[model samples]
Target: MLSTKRAKSVEVRSKPGRIYTVLTTLGREIAQGIIPAGAVLPPECDLESRLGVGRGVIREAIKTLSGKGLVSVRPRHGTRVLPRRDWSLLDRDVLNWLVGQENPDRELLLAVQEVRSIIEPAAAALAATRATKTDLLRINAALTAMEASDSQATATAADKAFHLAILDATHNPVLQGFRGAIDTILSAVFVVAVDSVDGWFDGNLPNHATIARAIEERDATKARDAMEQVLGYTQTHLSKPKAGTRRRAGRTGAGRTLSQT
Candidate 1:
């Protein structure tokens, strides 16, 4: 029998390869609640046959799940799915799998926005007070890229970059760590927000410039206000339906062109 240390080492050093496939498929299922908490995973041999992988691969996959707090493995009993709270909620793959659910988790989305409301306003205020010329240049460059983007996809990416640039301007390591959580939700919300409102980016494109200009002027209050407006627009546009359109939570609409801006 392999020692626990040896098993973990093998799982980590080996290319994941087939194990990644199994982990993603099963991990997504677990994240989506298809395999609910407390359910027992299939026996090793059964998983091997079902997933078309060797015993070693099965063991490694189980170990991977264990590390994520998704399952608890035992010597006699089968691996049991742990409670959702026990899972590593911040793990990238776990979050991605959660994103795969047909109905995106609104609560989770709102939670991220709440954190943004708390962190970004302060970060923008600090940036306004402390940003150097080079920092301001990066922020303006991102704004320019956003304006020049040809497609909604490109615009969304540029929009994220603009905010990340502001975060970088703050120059505080502890606050910078908050970015990982924000990044996880930014894309999800951007896609959903654009889809929720007609010409969303067209109406909001100038708000990012508002933030950049305020920071350039070194007006802490204006910078904070501008960032709050940007986030407020995100919340309002995502939460409320378009004037004539009934609420379409997941519909992908034809977004307005950003190239003309």
Candidate 2:
């Protein structure tokens, strides 16, 4: 008679708090593009045995990542990474990890800026009309820091805080949902533009001030125009395609990874 253990049926055990490790390891693989998107993950029993973990731990880890838009689960389809577009760019942890990936592509960086152009100005206008006194104070404080800072990193920090404050002022979760993409765009745009301009703070403060003033006045059109100016400036210096470049895979940066969200 064949032993029962010889059958493929599996048992899952609950270890301590190590479930997070499995999640992170999977997250890192997702980030590094090691595992391509749309690939179905192994079954629970298979994954648990391969990862040397209990079924409970594997399930929890999968749930955590799934909620973050990193993985998808279907009864017949198993689990898969969502497409990059479906990824929650607003997730702070996800944003940080994506940015930290090696030599991320410039086109991807520019795409982030394009997404910002679509979302941020409207958010700013909304904030202008809706911001409370406390929100205004926070906005002013962030602007003050940016205006006073002489260093690139410090100024970028201030600029980032300023935008975040504007988003918070809107008090609309839908509007606020683009925070991670906004932050990524700001960071990458600053990195790119810093090379072409001297004293990045000095170069940008005028535009920032104009935008802030328009927001303070609750002038939606003016705010949008000012935002347009900022985007125009960025595109002028950073978004241009060189003469010899191809459509895709042309940029000499770490290329994009295709994955499920």
Candidate 3:
């Protein structure tokens, strides 16, 4: 695991890789909406000082940005940020790290969830119409692993694999685009919130079974609804305050255990 200090030092490397790192950091800032589109970048000298690199390194990083369609360089003029669509979002590495930046914005989080809500169900529906025998087997393999896992961490990884398998069944280029969004959002949410929730893994067996059965039956409607129901139930279960914890109890005059209340 890269510690925060080490991660921040991504620019300390040499030559080709160093320029790539600098471009990636600046690109990340642009994607996260810190460096607004069409905003003029600082002069090369200032950028070199701020980025703690040589002037040549700054020039190389800017050249990389231009290559990536992130910046416009003119004749004897300054560099300017380009539109977001021009940036290579299809670059998986960009999407992977961009979503896990220091703090993802609330709007970005909602964008990811909204994309999932739209795409995952559609993918499941398409999979119902077109999945191969091997696709079903792959998904079921993850299901079996999830069912057998006793540890919270292993169960969560199995859960991720199961969803990715569902996406793999779609066989449509467009529907297949949502896999990374799901992975990054869930990873970040698990780190920041879900991993700390009590009873998150305890009641999920039945939920998992229901989802697996729907997929096995190749029932699109059932699979879609079961996915939504599982997500909703898990959210509600995890949202409750745990018993004997210092969280302010409601007006019910009793502090009930989360699942018991």
TM-score, per-candidate, Cα-based: 0.77, 0.70, 0.66
Clash count list over all predictions: 0, 9, 0
Q: In model 2, how many backbone clashes occur?
A: 9
Between 1 and 2, whose TM-score is larger? 1
Off by over 4 Å in 1: 1-14, 74-77, 100-103, 241-261
Task: Give lDDT tens digits, candidate 1, residues 36-91.
Answer: 99999878888889888888888877789899889999878889999988987766
Q: Which model scores highest in TM-score?
A: 1
lDDT of 1 at 237: 60
Global local distance difference test of model 2: 0.68
Give the root-mean-square deviation of each candidate in angstroms: 6.1, 9.7, 8.3
How big is the positional error of residue 177 in model 3, measured in Å on the Cα after superposition?
Answer: 2.5
Query: Where does candidate 1 have its weakest 10-residue lDDT segment?
Result: 242-251
lDDT of 1: 0.76
Which pairs clash in the backbone of model 1? none
RMSD of 3: 8.3
Model 3, position 245: C-alpha lDDT score: 31
